[model samples]
Target: MSEGSVRFDSDALQQRILALRGERVMVDSDLAELYGVEARVLNQAVKRNAERFPVDFSFVLTKEEKQEVITKCDHLQRLKFSPHLPRVFTEHGAIMVASVLNSPRAVEMSVFVVRAFVRLRQVLVEHPDLAERLDELEARVARHDNTLSTLVATIRQMATAPTAPSRQIGFVVDPLEKKE
Candidate 1:
């Protein structure tokens, strides 16, 4: 297939990526759709090449995780009634899926998938302040005793914290000194 034949939106692909189990991953259905194949077909291919997919590369979602995903992502609501738990694929696993499918569409779309993952990584690296803030927020949330008011106060205090004034490089005369 020609490059133009398979069109994948990077933004849409990015939206499909979710932070699950502390790793950024795309659900099997999402990947299957992107690869121009059915979810069942995609899973079958992976099963055939089971050795390629290690725990880190891909993992099946637990019941709790499935429920959480369905609640969080409106698009994944279809899986809510399905008996089988959905599998999630990290960046490496996504690429592997493309290879296993061995189709032109999958190969072409994999490039876009990899780019989306890289773009997310670039975003985190470029805006470290955002990551730091998220970490701080997580820590605050972890503290069971901390109320919302206390968290707000802590943030406000940090925002209003004073910084040291810069010293003048060279000044010969004091304002109070007489000129004569």
Candidate 2:
């Protein structure tokens, strides 16, 4: 095979990442595709180094969770009908897979993968005030929300409220015989 200069697209790798069960993760198939290996090979490596991959590092999806993922991620639809449940690896577990594989290519790919995860994290960390600002905005909106609601309710009540009966403006004159 001829080797040519190729650039790693961190953005593309980031797309494969997912949030599952409240943790950011990469599915086994996606990780294998990224590492240029068969998914089975990657799974084998993980099974061999199962100790390194604790529950936090990696976990198998339950049937219901698997269905939920299939519905959420278009790329994972293939696994929807497959009997075997898929495995998911957190940022740390993905790194462990590379060490377990012990291949030159896997090691090199791991560097890029780790960088991708770190890049995603850095992007989030850079905006530490984002959550704070959102909270402040919500509080401000909520603070005035009651006042606004009351004002609207008062206007609606005035509009719908009964009005006082009006008195006759002009002097009364008998219809049958009018006298000035």
Candidate 3:
């Protein structure tokens, strides 16, 4: 994943991230990896330009939040090895940060991340009606509160009538389970 340079649009990335959650708060190390710089360097830049980053713009993770994030994101477990807690930055903070760092790569990559956030936000917004409807249906199902035959029939109707897509999502026990 770190062989050569690839072209990326920071604007698009920012947009995608915004769509995801109006914020592009990624761990410092992940940003460093994307920008092809050391995480220490990014921190240094932020420290040097402290005025540009406010509480909303950027801040170090709280100890409790850091632990929670680490647990949720398996890929970040290695962060435990570091002495310092990770930092998170909102979109505005990230954009300001790229300038402070003043590296072409950082600037370009920041735009890509920004666009990505925006795209995510857009997807969620676009589905508001569908999301609301699904929530209502779920609430109704919960109110019924029983795995009745009528409920099963309704669920089955929602499921494939056997002619729809054969493949469906489901959970399975460990495939290698030993037979009792």
Name the candidate that leads on lDDT: 1
TM-score each candidate: 0.74, 0.66, 0.60
Ranking of all predicted structures according to TM-score, beginning with the best and ending with the worst: 1, 2, 3
Q: Count backbone clashes in candidate 2.
A: 0
* Residue-wise C-alpha lDDT for candidate 2, range 32-54, written one tens digit per residue: 88667889999998898788999
Off by over 4 Å in 3: 1-4, 7-24, 129-180
lDDT against the true structure, each candidate: 0.92, 0.84, 0.71
lDDT string, candidate 1, 111-162, tens digits: 8889899999999999989978988987977684568679899999999999
Residue pairs with backbone overlap in model 2: none
lDDT by residue for model 3 (111-152), tens:
766666677668669887876796799798877876576789
lDDT of 2: 0.84
What does the lDDT come to for candidate 3? Answer: 0.71
* Stronger candidate by TM-score (1 vs 2): 1
Position 14, candidate 3: lDDT: 40
Candidate 2: list runs displaced more than 4 Å.
1-8, 128-180
